[model samples]
Target: MNKPVNRHPFPGTPKRVGRVGAGRGFSAANSNTRISLPGRTLDVSAFAAPASHARPGNLGLNSDRLRAQMIQRLRNQGIQDERVLDAMMAVPRHVFVDEGLASRAYEDAALPIGQGQTISQPWVVARMISAMCENRVPVKVLEVGAGCGYQAAVLAQFVKEVHAVERIRGLYELARGHLRELKLQGRVRLSFGDGMLGLPNTAPFDAIVVAAAGIKIPQALLDQLAVGGRLIAPEGGAAQRLILIERTGPAAWHREELESVRFVPLRAGTQS
Candidate 1:
């Protein structure tokens, strides 16, 4: 859980706004909250303690063993990237979810995180990140539909910087709080804006991962991708498939379809 201190200052205002096809364009509002590290460190002894010492009815709620088991499940499900697995294991999923749902955090299931959005299933997160990093470890990354900030936090483990945008104000705030609690505000920058538009000011990302599914990939996102970079998103309506787009040159791009997925529809504009 130890992270390097960010030497550089946070980036400035979001510059570009992506077009959402028939919908209007929207800008991102960056979170300016100062970084604050927690005074108390998390006690992880429970995770290392032997199972024989476990108390009755204690389902290893805070145990690292649960995370290890989750990682094993991801491997069995076809997640091969060791970096992705380690990153997922490093993050505590329960921290980004609701208290009531904490017990089920490592269950490989998507759980509600308020505002009609759910923290994505663990497998999907690992898959998208694994795909994005397959070619090269991206230095800068953008994440659309950054619900609860879990994916972005996980991305931070593999990427140098992460810029995440969320349209819903409540989820935006919720994500901000969760990231701060995890002391990841430096590595992951959370923004309140339309995710469909993508963060233009920080354009030309080495990799872009969209959490929600759109009927078609947004052009603005495609344009913002750096040359040789890749963008992975879910595309379709009624039924959806994971789409991976690689920017080969200034005017040339390549698209490939992989595994079917279900995600909240990608929307334009911001929610109050």
Candidate 2:
């Protein structure tokens, strides 16, 4: 496997704040501190979630009704994994997007989330997650390019734990705030680092999902998968196709090509 050119710092250990309640907003207790990465120091306060922004207010849409409608559309599209469907239904998609676009949150379309990234369309998210959960429920999962943390939130509903990494500092902090607002920080660990590296400290994940397209799957990611684990990512440029890789044995892997899809090119290193 090839090594990453640069290594970024991970966030400081999360401290326990007060209990999080529904519709109630809370910030990290250590939000005011600073975390020192290998070559950079970041002000943790920038990642804090304010009470006002924690829970989105009335966005001119009936959240539950719209979510139900979206699930119906998924069913129509052949998303058979009941677990994935249930999870998609449970999470309020609007909260992860800007208020201006909240009305269209339930639509099967990808919306911009700043920083040149989009919260993936509902169908693609459901499809990728369903493919991972087809055979068995993954105990530990890693999500690369966790834009706004929407997919990780949905994955957390059925999986034991989800470790998500984002290379863009803005998106990483955005994801942190959103997950914190949903009170899912405990189940989903958000890391601000290079997604190509694949979180070595928490390696051998049962399943992995990459949100962007790459010329080829990162070798580091392949090595991180445990035996019997599976990874889903988009490969190729311009004409991209979703590929599923299964770690069949210690040194062997099986690859299958699935539906064609489009996504932003996956890049290396983090950006401020």
Give per-residue lDDT, candidate 1, residue 101: 67
- Over 49-160, each residue of candidate 2 has an lDDT whose tens digit, in order, gives 2222444567544889999999998876667778888889999999987776778889877665544345667777777787766768799999887767788999999899
lDDT of 1 by residue, 60-177 (tens): 6555888999999988666777888889999988777666667787886656544343566687677777777674778999988675678888988878989988776766777777
Clashes found in each candidate (C-alpha, N, C closer than 3 A) = 3, 0
Q: Judge candidate 2 against the unseen true structure and give its global Cα lDDT, from 0 to 1.
A: 0.69
**Each prediction's Cα lDDT score?**
0.66, 0.69
Give the clashing pairs for model 1: 15-201, 16-200, 16-201
The alpha-carbon lDDT assigned to residue 122 of candidate 1 equals 80
| Model 2 steric clash total | 0
- What TM-scores do the predictions have? 0.77, 0.78
